[model samples]
Target: MAKAYRSVIEASMAQNDSTIDSTIDSTVDSTIDSTIDSTVDSTIDSRHDSTIDYAIDTTIDSTIDPIIDSTIDSTVNSTIDSTVDSTIDPTVDSRVDSIIDSTIDSTIESTTERRYS
Candidate 1:
C-alpha cells in the first residue's frame, strides 16, 4: 500500500509538470506573436509617415521653385533693361544725330561753293 501510494504521487507530479510546460510554451508563443504584430504595425506606420512627409516636401518645392525663378528673372531683366535705357540709349542717339547733322551741313556748303564758283 505504501508503494502504490508513492507511485500514484509520482504519476501526479509528472502530469503536473507536463501541464506547466504546455502552459509556458503557449504563453511564450502568444508573446512572440504579439511582439511580431506590433513590430509590423509600427514599421508600416513609420513608412507611411515618411512617405507623406516626402510628398509634402516635394509638392512645396515644386510649387515654390518656379515662382521664385520667375520672380528673379523678371527682376534682373527689368533692372538691367531699365539701367541700359536710362544711361546709354539717349547719349548714343544724341551723338549720332549731331554727327549726321554736321556732315549734312558741310556737304551742302561744299556743293554751294562749287556751284557758285
Candidate 2:
C-alpha cells in the first residue's frame, strides 16, 4: 500500500511539472515574438516618415526657390526702369534745354554787339 501511494504521488508531480514547463514555454515564445514585431514595425514607420518629409522638403526647395528669385529680380528691374523714366529723364531733359537756350542767347548778343560797335 505504501509503495503504490508513493508511486502515484511521484507520477502526479511529474505530470504537473511538465504542464508548468509547457505553459511557461508557450507564454515566453508569444511574448518575445510580439515584442520583436512591435519594435521592428515602429522603427520602419519612423524611417519611412523621415524619408517622406525629406523628399517633400527637397522638392519644394528645388521647385520654388528659382521661381521666387526670378519674380523678385523682375519686380526690382521694373521698378528701377519706371523710376528712371518718370523722374530722372525729365529732369535731365529740362536742364539740357535750359543750357542750350542760354548758350544761344549769349552767342546772338555777342555777335550783335560786335557788329554794331
Query: Number of clashes in every candidate structure?
Result: 0, 0
lDDT per residue as tens, model 1, 17-93: 99999999999999998987899878989999999999998987899888898999999999999988998888998
- Candidate 2 matches the true fold with a TM-score of 0.54
Q: Model 2, which residues run further than 4 Å from truth?
A: 1-39, 100-117
Score each candidate by Cα lDDT: 0.94, 0.94
State how far residue 105 of model 2 sits from its true place (Å).
Answer: 4.6
RMSD of each: 5.3, 5.0
Report the error of model 1 at residue 93, Å. 1.3
Worst 10 residues of 2 by lDDT: 59-68
